[model samples]
Target: MKLTRLITFACLLFWLTPVAGQSLKSGAANNDEIIYHIFQRSFYDSNGDYHGDLNGIRQKLDYMQQLGVTSILLTPLYESAFYHNYFAADFEKIDPKYGTMADYLKLIREIHRRGMKFYMDMETQYVTEDSRWWKKAFGNTQSPYSDYILWDDKENKKPSTIVFNLTGLRGYDGVTRKITTANLNSEASKAYNLKLFSYWIDPNADGKFDDGVDGFRLDHMMDDLDNKGRLPHLFQTFWNPLLAKLRTINPKIKIVAEQANWFSLGNEYLQNAGVDGVFGLRLCFAIRSFDKKLLLANADSTLAMLPPGKQQVVFIENHDVPRFSYGVKGDLTKLKVGAAFNLLMGGIPAIYYGQELGMTGTSANFGATDANEIPDRQAFEWYKSDTGKGMALWYKQTGPWKDQFNDDKPNDGISLEEERNDPNSLWNYYRQMIAIRKANPAFVSGSYKTVNNDQEHVFSFIRKSAGQTILVAINLWDKEAEVVINAGGNAVNIIGDVRPVLKEGKLVVRLPPFGVGAWELK
Candidate 1:
């Protein structure tokens, strides 16, 4: 009781609230939201057909819960022609490949039952050529839907960015099947989009907010989220108005933008347009650079840039980029170091499914072809026995590309089947770090300050809130490193693997080649 009293006193002295009203009102600092981003088709296949479906994800909720995932972000489920599902054909339908509307509602209920949030990825900015609107407008520009589609010519250009597709309609990897960019300037498009977003949020039209997703990942959103220059004022005009309506329907709904690119960070998006968060692409690239100065500077600048009530989702790998495991060739020590940095950082952290097991896969080129995004979207590798089955390598023997075996993929027994049994697996490393983040409020939502260290390869920082201070030291190298951090207190070695001593009031520790050690000092 006395020890608890002393600890409480220590924490009270260094209050977590940097701003009293902001901290007390929303208590955003206590929001330790961690999302597991999944390309549903590749996660886990429930049936024998090899395509992962809603039931597959439902079966794996236990695995996600065990890993401490508080929410999930799935690739778009709307009916579309391609495997990635970015091009929506029918906004009202859940792709048959995935399952029916009943399956979706069941998944949502199961997710809510387990006390997890669901966030859907929505790309209402464009639609496939066969869309009802596109089909009607393509042949007859005089159709009522004419104003909804963006055409290169009023009557005859055929809408081509890929020879015959317009810029917004043609996907980078050549996947958009004659995409018809929605005209945000048109009231018709705005009404259609609002109804679509609203339908998913409250499908039954009953007052209960339980049936719809808790949040949304607005894909490829730009001020010109639809297409640049076509409608410059769309965001300030259409999006702000639409989002305002959404808030009225479900006030707690979170809206995060996958902004156009890495340099998109700034206060303008959140302040002017009112997006809840944007991808921290700049920080993500820096962390992947494997450089200490840039990594530290970028992280500091980013956290400092955000105004309260806004967030930047931090991640090392995602569906769009090459796997982090591939960057380091699946080295266990390096993977753990990166894991420590990612989970401990204050911004909302996300894990691309299989990132923990050192999964390696990517479709690096942006050329027009089949499953141009397939390599990285490979199966979750539940078992080591079958390579093609259950994996979402849908492009195998389909056409322009063949089966790509990622040489960097972890060796046999690294699959979930094996890692679940092994105590010291990379998966276990992620599990531990997430558990630590959940246990320590400072690690997930506290204020961040860099801990200066003379060692060139060592990067250290202090994450503090209330009175709890967490010192995270990372060695971004392949050799053993001895570093000293300038923090003093009654310290508890957060991770048991390495013990740091307090000599003359400073913490001293040694990090193995690419090792990480976190400490709790209060």
Candidate 2:
């Protein structure tokens, strides 16, 4: 069935909310809120074709709704040369392979009906060889799109200004790369790239751009082009104006950039571009490496680096990188703890698809060094009976389970379906942490203070806002340890997982092996 039709029917199953309220609240933060990542192709179809269609996602509105995900980030849904949808073939089309234009509209309607927002990933560089823009530019050297794409000039008289294709390819290879001299600047190339960008934002069918997209995620801004080291400035020239026009369509529109390579550069780039938020690389790296100290420290540092009122978007993983479980290599406990921290942290938290379950992959597979990674890019697991009452049914229902070929041996003891119903499961813990964060104002947009703990294996901190305080303590160690909480006052145990007692005006708490606990001030 068509995705729109499925969404319209699904709309009947839930109570709808207004679109205005779906915008981010100006105050601190809300814990129940979440951004769920979905690769455009991973959504389902009734035909059993195996490729995820828009309608497939529409059919599963209940799954996302139940999880309280406030926003859905669709990874690069635009038409691309590859299934991954990075190399843009046509920005206008909605990738017929995913679904029809109507299907996308239905998705927007269904999502808004549930009071949730949707974000589409936009890859800024490299359109396909056969793209209309490219063909038009090539055919008419003086056409409007002539300056929209890149091409190498074959004839160069001056030896000093001449350049060589480092990747051993032809001119303007956006895929491989090139190195140009300092004196050599291509006004024509810049104009061409900007023109193509303008086409994406051209909504009214006229040459002049009017209405375009809700927002954009600037791709590959960190890399230097032409060795100028002015990529951000170049982006601002093209993107800043485009952002202004997009905001005119919806004042609340958000623009996030993928400034991955480094945290400092990403932060600086976002600030310079006046973006709403930046992808949090620090949190992602920590979760992927299972280095608890580094994770907590990086989170702290990222928070410190941001200017007041500007926020960061936290995620366990994204499309460009490997999945957290696969990246972390089956450390379910660390994954759970990292997730809890992400939820409790002050920034907006994003969850990539298939992260809730413990997914695993090796460097040989996902790192681009080996050919095996292609097969490892398996789809999510959706439906299969829980083996031994272990929650296989829930896993199958929640996942695009057929994505993985080896159905017989799945990740050991990792299934969102099982955890959703089980109160003590990791899923339950996440839900509870979100609930606690939501109920308390301190956890939202509060000030963070690191409490001095003697044990290096333990990480502790407090969130204080509007005179309320919530302390979070994690036993990064494998064995039990004593947590000393010196709040200088009496605080109530909110989660009740860990019991504490007052001693000499300080709160002493006993932590279990690899345990975590939270407290609330009375």
Candidate 3:
């Protein structure tokens, strides 16, 4: 729990100093964050319920601190019939399975006490049949909440569904529950959302935000709700107004939206919507593909889309996407490469839980059910045997989803306990990369520019902040490569194995297969 300030020497190229315990002031710049995204149900369990809870997260702060993340983002914790807690049954109440409201408050307070921020994931667009609005407004035209739930019929016999006209979704409990979209245009619904958001921003309305979440992750945010063409101009009408009001309560409350379209650069959201950040999905896909041209193009366009005071949450894995290790077939070298790009890229980097340990899982096709995503959201492996006191195997021996769980293996070096002591482990690589990033300003809040290289297999770039410049090169191929960068500078090796050599007017570096290198230019 000892905290020390990092001192960087001009002559030294690499410094593996830990900055985890450093106290970050509240309302810090969005670009200053390095987030760790967690799916609580798959994380550690404090009790004997086989399910991860708020208290469980509070117990793992030390683990996250050692991993060098400044913020924590949890998926929805609201009461929901689904296992992922997306389709809320009640927006105001915390899911009983996760814990009580008191537990949530304690968790948030503990996060803030450790100088770490917590972002709550909210999907207020749709609710299940158990929701108060749906129960009261589904069939009663005279109900005061009649306009709260969107209805497709004048007689209120049919309710509006979400994307693909999904009237109901099968929960992990093997029960299909009907879902209906909220009437976003209804002033009553808008006011209710604003009140709900305000409550979470300052739970006790004490003006101080230490007890509440520092921000929110708006799930599946879009101007046109569900792309059904029924709701339009929501950016100008619904989001902007509500977010603007929330800003009045806490000007520093950060809101990051998940653009509905994965292919989008989220420019429209940044321009029109009152959001501080959005997921850099295009760059993430590009990095996963390991295509230099695609990576360069996406990186450039993604960064260019951000206006001042806004940021892109650059990440390779999330609760919705397949684990990055699965895409690479658990290749250690490739996983390390991913870690480098995730932390060193010029954006607000986010590390998904278990990503540092190279956990592998892919989305499975289980027709018309949310269970298909359970593979990607399996329990966190705490021990080498994948069984421990705090292990949260909530879905174990459940069904097809459990059969497809490909994340944990005995002695597979994919658990924190296995990787913590190994110097060359994916976990250590992530820790070192994060330390290097935190110690260097260029990697944290720098301007990114692609550095031309001679080898097609190597991708090179420079991150410059103030007067400091750092050159980074990665060999994406499966063989060793010696690449010559066009930039002329005397570079000192920093984080990776590649040693830069200056010959004539260019810098040359040799990289092993799937190797990443960074140098501080003199």
Whose TM-score is greatest here?
A: 3
For each candidate in the order shown, give its overall lDDT on alpha carbons: 0.74, 0.56, 0.83
Candidate 1 lDDT, 1-522, residue by residue in tens: 000011221242222212222211221355778999998987877666667889889888999999899999999998977777776798888888788899899999889888899999998877767788888888687789887776778683565331123343333234446565777778899999899899888889796867889999987676755344667866688879999999999999999887663454544666777789887776776677677867765666566456677887889888877788877877888788778877887788999998987788755453444344566677787765536445654444344444444532445656877687788899888898999899888876687777787688988888888868888888888899888778777677887578888888887888888887788886
Q: Model 1, residue 256: displacement in angstroms?
A: 0.7
* Model 3 C-alpha lDDT per residue in residues 425-457, reported as the tens digit of each score: 999989999899888888877877777999988
TM-score of each: 0.89, 0.76, 0.93
lDDT tens digits, residue span 1-522, model 2: 000011221232121211121222232433334788776464444345556778778777787766656778777777764555655667668777677877777776677677776766766445555466555655466666544454444222211211112212121112321212221124554444445444434444463322333445665443354233433354456555656655554566677776634334255655576677777765556544444566555655555455545667777665555556664455656666767667766677787666665544422221211122222334555533323321122112322322333432554455554556667666666667666777778876676666766676777777778768888777765788887766546667776566677778777888876677888866
lDDT (Cα, 0-100) at 12 in candidate 1? 26
Candidate 2 structure lDDT: 0.56
Candidate 3 clashes between residue pairs 3 or more apart in a chain or in different chains: none
**Candidate with maximal lDDT:** 3
Candidate 3 has an lDDT of 0.83
Lowest lDDT sum, 10 consecutive residues, model 1, at 1-10
TM-score of 2: 0.76
Where's the lowest-lDDT run of ten residues in candidate 2?
1-10
Please tell me which model should have the higher lDDT, number 2 or number 3: 3
Candidate 2's C-alpha runs over 4 A off are 1-32, 154-215, 223-232, 263-265, 287-293, 327-331, 362-377, 385-412, 416-418
